[model samples]
Target chain A: DAGITQSPRHKVTETGTPVTLRCHQTENHRYMYWYRQDPGHGLRLIHYSYGVKDTDKGEVSDGYSVSRSKTEDFLLTLESATSSQTSVYFCAISRSGTTNNEQFFGPGTRLTVL
Target chain B: DQQVKQNSPSLSVQEGRISILNCDYTNSMFDYFLWYKKYPAEGPTFLISISSIKDKNEDGRFTVFLNKSAKHLSLHIVPSQPGDSAVYFCAALRAQPSRTGANNLFFGTGTRLTVIP
Candidate 1:
């Protein structure tokens, strides 16, 4: 509802293969984030970008990499996929990091690594 | 180490009854708290949020209570309906902006609420 969309809503791939998920937003928010949801772990932050070409790692940034070349597109790539990387990935955007830090999330990408 | 914790993994309540979901945090610097609801196959949607400055914040049937001294927070849904059944996640973030130029949120494991009709 926040003008966010994630491509490839679902995918299944074998281990050791390269995979990438894309998050696109139309709101032109200043912040973008990538998160993964797993059982018992909830949603863990993978990476986030505050502005174009500015990015940082999150709590669970291991085994993953992200790039933000433009304001609307953020990409999450798993160089060599592993079984542990399989999870529902979500992208979020917010106008700022002040008191009103409410983040709007995209539909999500369900990636399965065999 | 989990900074935020949601001890309950699941909860059940009859429709029209009040449903309470609890969350706890270990960090004292966390000044903001939020609740998110997620339905199956969909991304989480923001439900409510509270700042440490206040003990309670209410919006419609959803109310979030924060106990600073106890490092705890709870969400109350009054007159719950079947549509309320979903996975609820509690998240926390510090008020200050991180040096990395992004403020990240730590989330709880989530509680599945089943509102029986």
Candidate 2:
């Protein structure tokens, strides 16, 4: 297992509230990713960071944003939570300079919007 | 459009039997493929992978077969155990140097494998 941890293993919030999920890695990997897992949809990438202050949108980046100001932390925020945003969010990290390298994952954060 | 797809939503196999999970992709630019297994309430873990230049790669009980011409890949687990029950995802990436920061993976919908003992 990689030294990756995601805060707030589970959360419940109102539809219009703001929600922030944090991912921290001790390995100091250069690549980090955020994904949401839903039934029938499997896992969809929301955003990813290649380095500090360098991030890009993924297939399902709409309504979600990410920030990586330091090497060890990656944060995913929902500006205004929505019911459709309720899902299992996962954080993954992979070392730089390797395309086939494996990604280590955090336990995951399950969010529910009411 | 879904570039990577796992058509089977779920699969069942008996203990000690062979469990075969299938995946397909429509993009020809994808040159590297990987399989990940996920247990409920936990994150997905890397299982196996195959490069486009290779047809098959194996590790322990897991084996991944890639058919570039057909744009398909399959994961095989022999002597499947109850612990093997989980949702498996297939992912693909376009070949690019890591320094370029262009490595983004497209994932499949996943197939839930249930091994009945």
Candidate 3:
């Protein structure tokens, strides 16, 4: 397994409150990604970082934001949590962001906004 | 719209039987395809992949077949076992320039497979 860990494996937050999920990796990978998984939607990328301080929006980036200040840490924040944002958030890392490289995932964080 | 589509929501197969999962895509630009397996409450793990230039790729009991003309792909698991029961996701990659790292991939709705013991 890859040296990846997600903080707050499970969380319950009130609607309109701020929430941040953390992804920490020890592999020193260059690429880090944040994804949310929902029924019938599979896993949709919210944001990804190619390097420190470099990030890009993904398919479902509307209600989420991300930051990568260091090579080992990537954070996902829900500015103001909403009930619709309830889902499993996953953090992934890859040695390189190429078709030939496979991304490894960390244990997901399940967030519930009530 | 979903660029990758997995029509089946769930499937059941007897142990030792061949299990086939199908996926389709609408984008012609997709040049790479991959499958990931996920157990409940855990993150998905990469299973197998096939490039657009190849029709098939196999590793152990897993085989991936791609048909570019039909924009379809299928995963075959021979002698399926109960351990193989999990949700499978199909993902597609559109190759982009190397500088930008076009690793952004489109995923389909997953299909849950239950291998009966």
Candidate 4:
């Protein structure tokens, strides 16, 4: 609802292949994030960027990489797709990545790996 | 370790009643908490948030109460409507000011709330 859109709302890939998901926002927010949601696991942060060219890993960053070269876009890449990595990927943004900032999420991309 | 935990996997509430969802966090470094509502085919949306400085925060029919000593937080919704039925996720924000890293949110296994009319 925050002018955020995640491309390829649904995707199917095979194991060992690389997959990239795109998150685009018209909010022009300074902070962007990527998270994965799974059954029983809820949602876990994968990566976040405070600004363009500034990105860092999150708790589940082992198989993921991210890049943010602009304020409106953040991309999440799966280096090598695995069945265990299949999940619903969500992108979020906030005016500021501060403690009090509330995040707005995009319609998730459901990725399936076979 | 699961820093944030939601004990209840699901909760059933009746219409015109109050629905209370609870969450607990083990990390003391967390300073901000938020509740999000998600539907079947959509991403989680921001419902409300509370900072560590206050004990309670209210927005219309929704209220969030925080207890620092026990590291517990609860979200209260009055007059639960049928549309209120969805999965609720509680998250805690961890800030690291020393580094250029952005703050990250730790989430709990969401609780699915069903409102019966």
Which tens-of-lDDT digit does each residue in B2-116 have in candidate 1?
A: 8999999999999999999999999998999999999998999999999999999999999999999999999999989999999999999887879865778899999999999
DockQ of each: 0.74, 0.64, 0.71, 0.71
Instruction: For candidate 2, give the lDDT of residue A79.
Output: 98
Q: Compared with the true structure, what per-residue lDDT tens digits does model 3 show for residues A1-114?
A: 999999999999999999999999998999999999999898898999999999998989998889999999999999999999999999999888767678889999999999
Arrange candidates, best TM-score first.
1, 3, 2, 4
Deviation of model 4 at A56, angstroms: 0.8
**Model 3 lDDT on a 0 to 1 scale:** 0.93
Q: Per-candidate TM vs. native? A: 0.98, 0.96, 0.98, 0.96
Expressed as tens digits, the lDDT of each residue in B48-115 for candidate 2 is 88999999999999999998899999999998999999999999887874444746778899999999
**Over 4 Å off in model 2, which ranges?**
B97-102
B102: Cα error in model 4, Å: 2.3
lDDT for A99 in candidate 4 is 61
Q: What lDDT score belongs to each candidate, Candidate 1 first? A: 0.94, 0.91, 0.93, 0.91
Query: Can you tell me the DockQ of model 1?
Result: 0.74
- Candidate 3 stretches with Cα past 4 Å from truth are B97-99
Each candidate's fnat, listed in order, reads 0.67, 0.54, 0.63, 0.78
By lDDT rank, best first, the candidates go 1, 3, 4, 2
Best by lDDT: 1
TM-score for candidate 1, please give it.
0.98
